[model samples]
Target: MPDSLAAALTGLAFGLSLIVAIGAQNAFVLRTGLRRTHVLPVVAVCALSDAVLILAGVGGLGTLVDRHPAVLTVARVAGAAFLLGYAVVAARRALRPGAVLTAEDGDAAPARVWPVVATCLALTWLNPHVYLDTVVLLGSVAGTHGDARWWFGGGAVLGSLIWFTGLGYGARLLRPLFARPGAWRVLDAAIALVMVAIAASLLLGL
Candidate 1:
């Protein structure tokens, strides 16, 4: 492969390796996608935010972030709180026997756009893990590509776009399984646990 192609492939693989994990952000995206609610905006925010972060990392902002530990410290506190709160909500939903996960529940309420977008932003921005992966780790890796760092960043950005798009849209395939209320309850319960675990990890500075 050519240098540029090699760099891009390296970036893509690296990016996917980091992002293809079960985390709060992925949980939110999966849930929202299952619900078919504001998938476009949610995916857009995630992909674009990632692109910005990756670029910032490659641009040497990672060094600046490292120099200022306080920024990440603040993010850690707030992100933990946010995750904890979200977990409580998810737990409540799971506990509610009447709460159906299917989008067609007669009592199912339509979600507004902005609130979902706000949550998406919070999930994307507030988490220090994201910064660590995209800015610090990816940035450091990109530096190794030398002049091809930008291409590497570009590939990472593309990876993010493809992942988010597929995840958000591909959720529809699970619609049949999620058609049952029990499936939704289980998913909510899992999400709640994941959120709590990540939040605790953040608080403990893990």
Candidate 2:
């Protein structure tokens, strides 16, 4: 393979490895996609945000972010708070029957667009893990590619786009399972646990 192609594949693989894990962002995307609510905007926001961060990382902003410990500290605190709050909401949803995640919720009024957009933005931007993954780790990795770093970053960007799009659009396949209100409760419970665990890790600096 050509050097450019090789770099691209490496970047793509690395990016997917970083993002394919189960996390708060993925959980939210999965939930929203299942509900078929604002899927396009949510996926777009996630993809675009990752693309920008990956570019910034390749452009050497990763080094700047590293140099400023204070920034990371603040982000860590804020991210923890947000995750904890989201955890509480998810827990409540899990406990309440026919509350939000009811399988028969199709007849329910659609959520306001602004709130969904806001949540998507907050989930994408407020998490310090995003910065660490996209800006610092990926950036440092791309720097090793020398002249091919930008090509590598481009591939990473593509990976983010593909993943988010597939996740948001492909979630329909699971619609049947989520058709049961119990499944939504289980899912929400899982999300709540994941969020709380992550938040605790962040708070304890683990």
What overall lDDT goes with each candidate model?
A: 0.93, 0.90
In model 2, which range of ten residues has the least summed lDDT?
A: 100-109
| Candidate 1: stretches off by over 4 Å | 106-108
- The CA lDDT at 4 in model 1 is 93
Q: Candidate 2: which stretches are off by over 4 Å? A: none
Per-residue lDDT over 108-189 for candidate 1, one digit per residue giving the tens place of the 0 to 100 score: 6768999999999999899999888899999999999999999999999999999999999999898888888888999999
Q: Give per-residue CA lDDT, model 2, range 36-74, as digits (tens).
A: 888999999999999999999999999999999788888
